[model samples]
Target: MRTHLKNDIPKFDIVHSHSLYLFHSLVTGHYCRKHGVPYIVRPHGTLDPFMYKRHRLRKMVMELLFENKNIKEAAALHYTAAEEMTLAEPVTFNAPGFVVPNGLNVSEYDHLPKNGTFRKKYPELNGKKIILFFSRINFKKGLDILIGAFDLVQQQHQDAVLVITGPDNEGFGDKVREWIGERNLTDKVIFTGMLTGEDKLAVLRDADVFALPSYSENFGIAVVEAMACGVPVVISDKINIWREVESNRAGKVSSCDHVQFAKEINALLANEELRSIIGNNAQHMVRDYYQWDKIGMALEREYTNILRTRERRPQSFKVRGDASV
Candidate 1:
């Protein structure tokens, strides 16, 4: 990125980054600085405690050395949600920051085809309530905990089916499949690999509930997508931007506990009235906050500020001088 910027000085304002933890962003930000470019860094919840808990030693050292240098040198920091800004403030001595939750293209689903082929593929889901989980399968995502919780949910609602979909990040997807087989839940749980476009919308639109048991998520695009489709979400508080989920009354948020997970899911599943109320709120919340155009305008304003700040300062280019004293 630095080399590319060096080659093509893309005349632009604020060179805002998505995440400082990512090597490319950090490097690019440094280049912008060298060329007298003013930029803003968005941590995107990468500094949350949940992420810090994973590689404590390495992360701590990086923070003290390179990471701190790169971030503290920026003009400002951009955060996607309140939790991210709160977690970031004490960790670094940097310029001011603001929250801008990630947005989605709502128009894409405007003319989506209505299809329930997923129900036909899995006969168990034919006349049952379908709880959808769509994201990469990983330990950090808490899929195992969800599976355990689903067993308890099944005890009460025999008609509910769990549909887990996403690309297999590691071998976790296969392991989950094995788990379902052992429990003889092969008929209850369905796995659909990486869905997109019409298929994705169809599933979301048909779902009775969207369950994301992730251990840590910066911004759950899937959560917003489900809400756009008027599906209530059941997620864990570990998702950094969970405030959006809660304030919207999109669904229930709890810890990554198996029992609590079951309780939340069961409450929503058994009570159709509560589900409808939550689903309505979810759709309203998306229309209010998750629209792509609104978010893009906000970002444009930030970039304009950066450009204005840069223009006010003197250019840093040096000129040759004669040393004839």
Candidate 2:
């Protein structure tokens, strides 16, 4: 890969490095600098504080050695959300930055499986108001908060079931189960392992609400996916896209606290009309802003701007957490 970059990197007008703290980014940035070719670096959430602290010492070493230089010399730093850019500022250190959100193929959700498809597969969930959490079962996902919130949610909506769908990461699923069992919610919460393709979309279609109270998320793609399916969402402010969800009135945004999270989830479950309103807003927002075609155009424009202004040093600019390009 390094040899290929050495030979071919100059052929391109510009380069866009996707992640940091790796040999690939290091080599790519090296070649771009060497050949005087412009390049952009997208941290892809790795620069968030929560993620950075996980392997503190190793990352610190990498930063001192090469990663810091790779970032400092880049033409521009691309962040998926403005909140992400803010949280990453200390690491990026006044480097030129821009926000461009991750997007989905809207057509993938146009013809989701029939409403009863998911219920048919999981008969026990039939007739129950489903609150779906679809993402990897990892420590950062804040399942503890969700479980505690769901326990409170059950007090008011007894017929509501919490459906967790994701592959367990590092045995975190076992720990999550223990938390549920401690609250005597083992029967109320169902783990579907990991659902993909039609099965995942079917579950999204049938959900009364989708909730993800992640402690830290660079960009919550799952939240957007649920919104695309016209499912009302209750996500924590820690998810960088929370501002977009709130600003668009597409969904509810709450603090990471279980009490607050529970209230948001319960409100959606209780009021079908409110859910419909927000769900419709969510779908429209996805179609208008989160679709791949729209996002692609925004990226193309950014690339064009970078190419046009290649002679000038990228100026430092402040981001106000807006989703618009």
Candidate 3:
């Protein structure tokens, strides 16, 4: 963003910004407008309903004063998911918008160590159907709902164990542990503080199912990661990529309801044949859709299209610097 501060910044075909709705975003947009350079904005779900409500008045005035105009005149606004596009307000303001799903770099999985990294560490998990919920222990992730759903899932599959892995955000992990203790799942649930690298892949490789009941997720990269490892997933429909999961038979997408989530998770655990079929399908879908190589080519195409249909630069353009300053 400091590039905008200099009076003599290098010329570029387009200024692509993947920032939140902050002063830096508006400044980048302002520079684009003032210099007649094409710009594209990626809100990365910051414009979603939940975030917009956080500072309603400030965002509203900022949008009117700077963001809206910048977006309206931009080459295009970029969205990572279809649902994100639909959720955007003033949808028509950005005359044209682009949707590009997030891509995964599979190299991270290329040299992954053997499975059971967790099992070797916690020998008690042996012979248990490990259901994993790997994400930050935050309210937005619906960890409580997942715990409730897992309670129901365990009743049907007595040997099933839930492993909640992730760093505690604002001590939410402690809160989740309290919930587990209250339900007498203290023995059934395992909490591994923040998992990464070989350890992360080991857990993903061994887990029977990967579940995330996020209240709102633009794209669940973890879901894709599970699919990449040939593991089935269970996610809430609130995830923007739910359609892709449902259509590809990658896994199940349930409503936010804990009961519904239990039903979906139970279905996968009850039928080994169904699990294998869905798991295989998920792997295939990720190979076909989520590869970073394929996504990079798609982005090249979008940039080419924009460059080809290049608009005339406005000579009289100047930054007001009123709101941005």
Candidate 4:
């Protein structure tokens, strides 16, 4: 697919890529370099410790070969945060780099009605505080820890409902089910595997708190989505963009420790006023800083910088007049 696109598309100023490990990104980037077209690379959390631990050998080989070469020769590296920049710096073969956070369509969740369809589907949550976990079901996502923490939260507030969403990853969803079964949390925990359109929006609208205990994240797009929906987030410091969560007072930030995770979540579960205040702050921050228009402007500046540099000095400058002339 990538090779075809590279062959078909006309060469351009910059071929910006979001994730280096993706086959398409690699093929496209190589094409750009081959044609002397400058490119920008975005690793998108691919270099995080969690990712390295999972695919160490494969990534190491790719790094030693094409990926490192492509990044090294590119116009610049694009990172979402300082954490991502640091991760890219040493491995990038000394490429130029800049940081720009992932952005979202903030208004999509603004002033959204608390749609009762989701509540009606699981009417049991009508009277309870609904804490939500919405994303892919994967080990690195830390769903197991989120569930364990919720188990402790249930002991304090029996009325709390833990709603887990997104598509299952192989057998991991079943593992989550078994854990919930063992804890006898069938009533307190609800699993809606992969929802979209109205169904997905409804879940966000009715959510009381959003929790993501990811072991590592480059930008946590869902975190911003929840914030745009006016939902307070409870995330771990391992998420590279936790600075946004902390500086904005979007929600509580904790270490990956399960006990600390449980304690922080319980604090929010017990205090509705605090949750509302923090949730409001989260919405404002995403709207101001992460909205596409704002984020696009930041990217535009980077593109302009790359273009300016390219114009000043081509890959090979040619003098218009010879020394004899």
Best by lDDT: 2
Candidate 1, 55-101: lDDT as tens digits: 77877776776678767787778877777788767776856777777
How many clashes does the backbone of model 1 have?
A: 0
The lDDT of model 3 is: 0.80
Candidate 2 residue lDDT tens string, 136-239: 99999989999999999999999999999999968999899899989999888889989899999999999999999998999999999999999999999999
Indicate the TM-score of model 3.
0.89
Q: Write the per-residue lDDT of candidate 4 for residues 1-325, one digit (tens) a residue.
A: 7656476433355567667666776677677777776677777787676675677788778777778787778788888888767765656667888988888876677556566767888868878888999899888888778888888888888888999989885778888888899888877888899988778888988888899999988878888888888788899888877877898898899888777888888898888899889989998888777878888778777877787787843333221211001
Ten residues in sequence with the least summed lDDT for candidate 3: 316-325
Task: Give the runs in model 1 whose Cα sits over 4 Å from its true position.
Answer: 60-65, 308-325
The deviation in Å at residue 137 for candidate 3 is: 1.8
| Stretch of 10 with least lDDT, candidate 1 | 316-325
Cand. 2 Cα-lDDT: 0.89
Provide the lowest-lDDT 10-residue window in model 2: 316-325
TM-score for each of the candidates: 0.88, 0.93, 0.89, 0.90
RMSD of 1: 6.4
Query: Which digits, one per residue and each the tens of the lDDT, describe model 3 over residues 7-78?
Result: 422255566777555767777777767776677777777767765577778777887888777777878878
- Model 3 CA deviation exceeding 4 Å by range: 1-10, 89-94, 110-112, 311-325
**Steric clash pairs (candidate 1):** none
Per-model CA lDDT versus the true structure = 0.76, 0.89, 0.80, 0.79
Q: Which stretches of candidate 2 lie over 4 Å from their true place?
A: 311-325
Q: List the residue pairs that clash in candidate 4.
A: none
Candidate 3 C-alpha error for residue 210, in Å: 0.5
